[model samples]
Target: MNNKSITAFTLLTATLLFSLIAHADIINTNTTGRNTFSHRLSNLYIPEAVGGETWFDDQNQYNKLDIVASGTAAYADITVAGTVVGTTAEGANIYATDNSGIGIAYELNYSTPGATSPQYAYVYPNKLTFNGSGYSLNGYMHLKYALVRLTQFVPAGPITQLPTVTVNYHNLGASGYPDLSVVTLQGISAQPQITACNINAPGSITLPPVNGNSLVEGAQGITDAPQITLTNCPGAINNIIYDFAATYYNTHSYVNGIFTTKQGDGYAKNVYIQLQDATGTGIHINSPLTLPGYTGSGNYAIPNFRIAYFIDSGTLNTVTAGKVETAIDFTVIYN
Candidate 1:
């Protein structure tokens, strides 16, 4: 979890999602000569799991009178906008804590109303989590939050230190004032580090088969008994997205989901390549493949994955003994 807070928001505007009658007085929290507020939501460093909670306190006590005589103080839809790359809003499992405590009483519901609409389903004055399907995030992620009461709100305890709403009376010869304040929420933005990996020796992969003819004739092809190691990648990278390409072997390029070698000008015919994970499982070059278990902090070495040249005896019928060589381009990436 290489999570870092890239920036902070100086101001936020309140927006009304549902129509509500106006009667309650509005007071600025910034009246105290302070326009900025800070919230430490560092817990969102890594996206919260589907059933996790990202706790946060607005640091503001709710004390606004009902605009409709029965309305309560509540926060509404979390409006999300701004630029995101590598993953879509749907791909990123973003969710807010709808209830209190450990959030275990109710089942987890992972849903979003497309990208345009702000995601809702949480009570106000609580914490929110990016509760979306797990995906390593890249580029920038920003979310805007707003508050609105949906129903009558009752404080668990006494309300104190609220601003004053004054009214004067001449006929009745009495004056009364109510404590009041506005609910202003802050926005959050983060930029987690991208996935990176360094290969040991990527220039040339030489496969020394037992013999050109016997190599293709044998039932099993060559294996990376001594795996080529990869190192220095972020711990968040659980898997690698990779593909292989070879112009000469373009006709017989993809074999068993692995990239293959080309028909050389020399002896090897119908020759191809096969890639396996550290566990010896064939890696599908078309999609992302899980990397070896990371140790949190250290260079990651892939001990199981290896590549070897194989000849399709059935197609070529004859395996040439002279020169069995073909160039291959191996590309590795983590999503």
Candidate 2:
């Protein structure tokens, strides 16, 4: 070999021998299978490392794990693991990701700094979010906590937190799904948020909570609508806002699936008064509510409707009472 080559080889051998003497604790390394990095990388500072390759040396000290897939949509979790050498310390588990679980690294880091003493295993939470549905990475990753399915926690049978879609109105069919008639739901004070179909939460997409309310104009004989309670409910107590007039209507008819009152008939329109709390005078029932029966059809032909010709009469001013009150009951027809 040339003199320069021989000299360079001698220098490299000398450096390796010196390193072995200095850091005798350095462990061996290997190219573990996909996502698995079992090598003990020698400690070092990484300027700008990328993924899809092994960045560890032998000691597993400071390894730069650059994990990536062929395309942005290829879901894969960039997982790393570290095991403590002896019994004095506890084991730690940390993970990070994007979409299905991919993460980024800032400077080279092999474990959580000063988190667990004598960290038995290494891997910290460095998860990120991704743009799904035909969208490439485009460099969008939100730091988030990915929920690990509760299989490791909960008991067998099954536990579920139910979120409900409810509508409280008047004249709901005795025991069937609710309906939204013209006495109907215009818009909820909190629609987008309060309308949920499943439970775990509106993941990825969320529902906005319904808060305040304003009235809509719909006096047609069609009876499915919301009950508007007028007033700003604060601490407690209540006050009557409006008294409704319901004595004028004779009778109404539900044609096909709609509530239609005969023109100039005696069908009435009145508000139901209930002591929502204990604020109103002489409100004896705490939870007793005034429900108007629908006699405008079949069995409903009897009472047709109550609370008609009803007056606020100031009897609804308790913690249970509010201002002006009205209700619309119907069914949610699923086509």
Candidate 3:
């Protein structure tokens, strides 16, 4: 009975243990960063031909994501999911808008500490991997659009309300699979006008050979009028402004409409060239002139334009000629 009581009195002790683990979520702390960007296609002055040119590029402009995480650094994969409008000829993704001839292109980039270069993915459904430690994420959106001459047409006026696509970024490693952000990039607001014109000018204009002895100072020697024809002009244009410049000049003098010729070997000496209007009025070089009665979309011959060889009030008696050749440069501005 004593042994049984001693055995029953023997103390019994038990220990219960519990373990707890903590996990920190990855978060973008830059709350004030803008997610919506506006782009304007008209301001780029895109050419009529389909060349797959980048009309708008936000590479310099980026929405930065300041990532903060707590735990042992681990690799996490991020993905992009959005509505793909189409693909470019080079196989790049195109996020289209309500406006035609203009669309969006996007890329996701990630960088970690001591990384030589950042990792980027432009094509959709692509995953970008990053270390869960201190890292950065940048989202870039651009406009690398092509113009379809047959199907797409420029708007009559500037478009303000250009619809865009909504893109979602997901953290595949996050618990329950949470979205990093929902972004909608808006195109830049601008009043863009596309005015294109094709010019037809002779490669070289020749004047009748004249005798240098028959010319006097401050008098015209040989005169000629060459035509500058502008064709394939869009009907939406209102005016065409043009100006001229001398390629080779002996001196920096372009006083009235006269510019000096090159004064070296194979060049005429004491000789000058002058630009004039139809009334023989000396038109100032580099002065912009608007085409008269320019309606739109047709072939037009520039009026009141004439080029002539003249001698200035300098030493005309020493007018020795070897070759009286010069070049003229012209620029046309369409509005």
Best by TM-score: 3
How far is 272's C-alpha from truth in model 3 (Å)? Answer: 0.9
Query: Per TM-score, what order, best first?
Result: 3, 1, 2
lDDT of 3 by residue, 153-216 (tens): 4332233444453444434344343454434455555434555577888788676666766777
Please report the candidate that would top lDDT against the real structure: 3
**lDDT score of model 2?**
0.20
Compute the lDDT of residue 75 as modeled in candidate 1: 17
lDDT of 2 by residue, 215-280 (tens): 222211122112332111111001111222222322122211112122323322332322111221
Off by over 4 Å in 2: 1-123, 127-142, 147-335
Q: Following a full C-alpha superposition, what root-mean-square deviation does model 2 have from the true structure?
A: 26.6
Over the stretch 213-313, how does candidate 1's per-residue lDDT look in tens digits? 45543224555545446664433333554454554544343435445444446554455566655565555555434455653323555445666655555
Q: What ordering of candidates by lDDT runs from best to worst?
A: 3, 1, 2
* Better candidate number, 1 or 2, judged by lDDT: 1
**What is the C-alpha local distance difference test score of each model?**
0.34, 0.20, 0.53
Which one wins by TM-score: 1 or 3? 3
What is the overall TM-score of model 3 with all chains considered together?
0.50
